[model samples]
Target: MRSFYGVVACLLLLQALLGANARAETDTAAAPPAEVLTLHEAQRRAIEGYPSLKAVGERVLQAGARVRQARSAWLPQVEASWTGSHTDLSDVDVESARRGARSALAASGATAGLPSTSVTGSIIRLRNLAGGAAALGGIPESVDSYRVSLGASYLLFNGFGRKHTTAVAKYGDRETRAARDEATRLLLQAVAQSYHAVQLFRERIRIAEADIAFNARLLKEAKLRNEAGAASLSEVLNFEVRSRAAEAALNNARNDYANARTALSVLMNMEDGTLPENVEVETLGVETEEQMSLPDGEAALQTAMASRPDLMRSQWAVKRAGATVGQRRAALYPSVAAFASRDASQGGNSRFGEDDFSTTVGLNVSYDIFTGGRNRAQIAEAKHAQKEAEYQEDEAALGVVSDVRQAVEDLSTAQKQLVLQRDNARYVEKNRDLVAQEYAAGQTSLALLNQSQRDLVEAEGNLALARVSLLAAWHTLRTATGETVKDWPLD
Candidate 1:
């Protein structure tokens, strides 16, 4: 059995080690490597590799891509298009088109030459060639048409809508990046909490093992007394019951350890259900009195508002919405577009190599003089959205302030608790030793010794909890400050 108090538990510290001789360390001139991961390193790996953070990273990339695609609109648009149609004219209103064409020709006073012999020859040649040899081969007057054109249109002007849209997209990109950082912070906080839980279980296992070893030796001593007729069978039975309970506790600790390992694996972005073998946990360190100090509530509130990422994102969202409003207002103005195109078609439809070519360049100006109240309604809607975004930004800022104040209070209380708990554990341990001595002298009952033992165990557990809470206190402060836990050791 191991000693208690200064080192209370005979823990299964090297519990998961592979086979090795106990003498392996002494024969080596070179020292064996210390492979234990410190708390800071564990927290680092958890935040840096976490899958939740990675998923958020993908979102950031996706939003950035939207910004890039929107910016692409500012570059010149280019396209090559080919269209071909062969129509069977059963559904065609040929008479209507002929009438429309004739009416159009008469209005233009161009049909005076339409019935002339030379005009007839020209019309027949144009129609026959365009309609294809099938038209001349008694194939009912169907039209075979092919058109190939390379065309492009750029918004020479759009009331500055593209500029605003580009601005909005840029803000959206920043919002996504901020969101990713926020996710990383939250994930790290969760990992730290769960990791501390695993450590608690580890300490429990250690305590249980120590109890088991102690009971085993105590049982032997009791047996020796029973053989000499100095102790009863009931005494052995009592020890056996405690031993069994200790075994159950150890099993529970092992189970908790396994689950905790799974949790850490997720935070480290390992494959699903990954658990490391032979991993070591560093012991919890003592906390300082000054670490418990708290500043004025108003300053803490301001710190949260100024540092929170969500608040920053809300501000960006408002800016983006305002930009959208500006973009909509810009849409109410005229847009200018300039275009130049060349066309040539031969051999029924090969517009590519044909010798014929024509080029035209001109400016087009388009403005909506009046549209059934659409533009006015759109501008109103954008303004309303901007107003809503402003409200959200304010709400987010207030929420950040409230959350930080709460975290500060929680951390301060936890720090004080850690100090008191440590002191309590030390006293309880001494009390348990005194009770054991009394039981040995037959001056105290077995029940009293047992109760003292339970008290000591409970005190140790509480101290471990307090240590874990101190770790969480730091995390809470960092989270409230919008400092990414991954970036923590700031400075």
Candidate 2:
């Protein structure tokens, strides 16, 4: 009997432990997911995935290609030419020269007024072919004398066209990079703003949820009071209506959160719910008050103008356009290049005998006297484009100024509104509590009690919105000021 009691006790203890373990797990699983994300994380992800950076990378590659093209102008350009002519030109010397090469080679150095090579027959042929056309393998009727020549030319000078063109290419790369940075700034700002909006709506939903729970409690109290003949049926019905409105508000808030999260994922190029799942909008990190510091207005504006990537891009664009003007103007000047050529030829006077050889070297110069005013028209177009770019740069500066001023104003206003809204919410919450106590003691009407609760919930919701607005405004100001990293303004 004693052993039987011990076994029963052991079984009961085991059952109790299992029940406690199950309850713990059930409670844990039933709790809501944790929330932890900050506006900065959203901005960071946006910059990493922004597409404009791709275009800038392409621009860098293009610039490198141009650099290679420009440098190639400095390298010797090699060319080859071969002639098989049966033409009966009045000036026979052209063909005669080709024939000369074959004759010079077959007749040996003696024909070209050079020493014989019986002692150096192999060496003699080298000297003969080196003599030129006839020695190379040409003839008087050199129709069969093949002439092979390697010619080269290099630009000795141009109105600094290649030099300036290279500079322009490099600057074009810089400009593209700046444009990409500007794109990044805009994207980051947008991400920050949108995420802030999501947080705002979520907090509104929280407020609404709290209001709904309170209303449900009020509703239960009203129903109980009506049953006890202390409250009217209409009071319970009115509380139910309030609860329904709160539910609707919570549903709308949830939809807004989902939309905002979807947008963020797309911007970051992430899985639709992956980033959002990892991010908890409710527990966003904020910069401490001690970390926050305000910038001087004039100084900030100046820094914005100096540091804004858009402005720098515009400035470089002006330079690029100016370089184009120089490039076009350069076309008017005559090109001066130095060239040299060496060749070999071999052919028979008839068809199979070597009687061909020749040698010659001379300077060749060329210039385009006219081209239907094409160069003039091109220069005129370039000047106009340069002017356009210059004006565009000026306009870009003005736009920057406007953006900076507006962001500053928005940040200032939102900060004030946030403070006021927070104060208003606190006061209304206290008023609601006081009214609830008075209503229970029969010192306040049901209508007054209901009105106080509604006002307090509205105040809380508005306060949440104000907080979001303030955060967005802070981001806008910092972005406009060209500040990528700064102490957070709201704690």
On residues 255-327, what C-alpha lDDT tens digit does candidate 2 reach at each position? 8878887777677667554454546655434534522344467887998998887998999999989888888
- Most TM-score-accurate candidate: 1
Q: What's the lDDT for all of these models?
A: 0.74, 0.75
Give the backbone clash total of model 1: 0
Q: Measured by TM-score, how close is model 1 to the native structure?
A: 0.76
lDDT of 2 at 230: 92
**Cα lDDT for residue 353, candidate 2:** 26
Q: Show model 2 residue runs off by greater than 4 Å.
A: 1-35, 78-150, 273-278, 282-294, 345-364, 485-491
